[model samples]
Target: MNGHSGNVFVLSAPSGTGKSTLAKRLVKDVPDLDFSISFTTRAPRAGETDGKDYFFVDDATFDRMIRTGGLVEWVEVYGHKYGTGKEWVSAHLAAGKDILLDIETQGARNVHGTLPDAVMIFLIPPSAEELSNRLRSRGRDPEAEIQVRLDYAKHELCEYPAYDYLVVNDTLDRAYRDLESIVLATRLRRERMGDTAQRILEGF
Candidate 1:
């Protein structure tokens, strides 16, 4: 049951679903929560710092990690590669720090395979039309790329049933509150509070 460790919260959503924004805000506003910065081969976008937003690397470095198994899971998307570090996740979880992992749906499933107790949260927009509108409003991708993302979102939304929680991002503030409540509820679960509960019983 991974007693005395920390909870791994896997947050996943389609591109332009505002998952990144929600993750950043949750880590910023919440206490004792760490963001698992992913490694990517993609070039830095505007205002994206090297170590903060992502650890930008070349294809060779990314391949090395894959070959050496330094990454827990990796995937290629839109011609760029992304991966999560194995050591970082292990060390943080051992230290009892709840970490938020923002990855794709497939990666989340892979993580669940190993960490069966990990909390999986799938975020979605109100509707498919709204998802397309959000993707188009970003202005980051062209018409074809946007269409590709929309098509993927439709497919990804179907996988939400596999997740532990489904959050509809109708409004940012409301969604944030939902995330906070989930964290609190998970923390207070009897399995996670084994030590604390035992101590209280001993006192009685």
Candidate 2:
């Protein structure tokens, strides 16, 4: 439907589900894929860069961007606001660059509404116990906060039906392969191959 414009790949998963790790790997391993760095109102963790990890901003700046219609999609997660910039995503996509959006389920749904053709993938843990173990292993949050995240994970899992693909991250290698296949398959879809199809037809 977007013709030759780039495709948007939206990846969403519950906290501690390895979504971020997979996204980083996908961009590193795949060709011509760009990761969309979102803006966040939360303080940066140690070793996190301002623009590389996220565009860390104050509440006022984030509110201003919201008022000026600069955000493509935004959501409040764990008391902090995170949003994707409208201009940046539009410019890169129009240049025919595939972009990966690592966002929450709500933001993914919002992006889907805005860009109907965007590919949405939901990552699932092998089991609830595994998810809880993963959260505890992080050692980043307090016990209570970790419980909150696990509770939220249950609700998030319910939204998997809405996603285009469900990737079970039981094993990292297998999950990465699945994610990679989805990216490749989307690029070969009929609508995205219009220009290539024309060139081939012309040769005949």
Candidate 3:
């Protein structure tokens, strides 16, 4: 709809659903797939870089961005702030590189509202029990937080109908194939490739 050369792909799922794992592999396997590293108020973990994994800003700076309308879409999760900077993503698209946004369901909705043409895909675990097990096995959060995530997962699943594509990650290999196919299909979309088509047709 925007006639821009690059596409915005929003991949969202509940915690512990293997979205990040698959996303890492997808970006490597697909050419020209750039990731929009989010800005976070939370402290960086071990070996995390400032501009790579996240912008790593403090709460005050994050609030200032929100107030100034610097972020394309920002959301607070588990008491921490996360956002995608408007200039960062817009510049990437202007340079003709697609960007993949790994965000939460609520953030995805906000992005969709702003960029109505953005493609959205929802990743789902094989089952709810499996999702719960994955979260518990991580042993990162306390029992109360884990339970809260599990409850949130159930609600997140309900938003599946909103996405353009539903990918059930039952196996890594199969899911990767599906993800690649989606990327390829989106890239080949006639609307996204009108210039290429005109060149080929006119033999210029």
Candidate 4:
């Protein structure tokens, strides 16, 4: 690990945990933060651009990327294949941009397995009841599916300790600040700070 090495941050959470909302807020608060646009087989949501929210591709194209090793990590979720492209992340990292990846727990695990030095954060809801409420509030998914998701969220929360940091999303503003602090602190690490690392060592 070196100061100049690009950082890869893996953010994981269950559906309705407010990971997306918190991530958006974090980027708005952090000037230099870059959100890695993921590749997906799912259709774009309303107002989401092709390259901005996700790289929309067919299943065959996604499979090709998988075979050709174009993705850093990929996973199938909710019947769609989603992945982060390696080139895009490497380019941003090489340019010294702090990148944040909003992904599912399985995808986060895959990224961690490959990029062990990367920082991993898990966002948690206040409770299972709150998670269900949030999901229901969205007005999506059938009752059966919502129940399924609630069950899945419970299982996902059990992996909290595997992450470098646990951010409870009771309040978006507070969670954003906590996540920003984590990124700033990580950037100050000796391995990532280079000359600053030497200066700190000298002072010590």
User: Model-by-model lDDT, in order?
Assistant: 0.89, 0.93, 0.89, 0.86
Q: For all the candidates, what are their Cα RMSDs to the real structure?
A: 1.8, 1.6, 2.1, 2.4
Among these predicted structures, which one has the highest TM-score?
2
Model 2 — which ten-residue stretch has the worst lDDT? 1-10
The regions of model 3 sitting more than 4 angstroms off are 1-4
lDDT of 2 by residue, 78-194 (tens): 889999999999999889899999989988888876778899999999999999999999999999999999999998999998899999999999999999999999999988888
Candidate 4 local lDDT, 4-104, one digit each (tens): 75677889998998888888877777766889999999998888899877899999999999999999899998899999998988888888778899988
Cα lDDT tens digits for candidate 3, 1-204: 235658899999999899989998888878889888899999898888999889999999999999999998999997899999999888888878888999899898899777788899999999988888889898888999998998999999999988999999888899889888998899889887887788789985
TM-score of each: 0.95, 0.96, 0.93, 0.91
What shift in Å separates residue 4 of candidate 1 from its native position after superposition? 1.3
Model 1 segments beyond 4 Å from truth?
Answer: 1-3
- Sort by lDDT, best first: what order? 2, 3, 1, 4
- What's the distance in Å from true for residue 163, model 1? 0.9
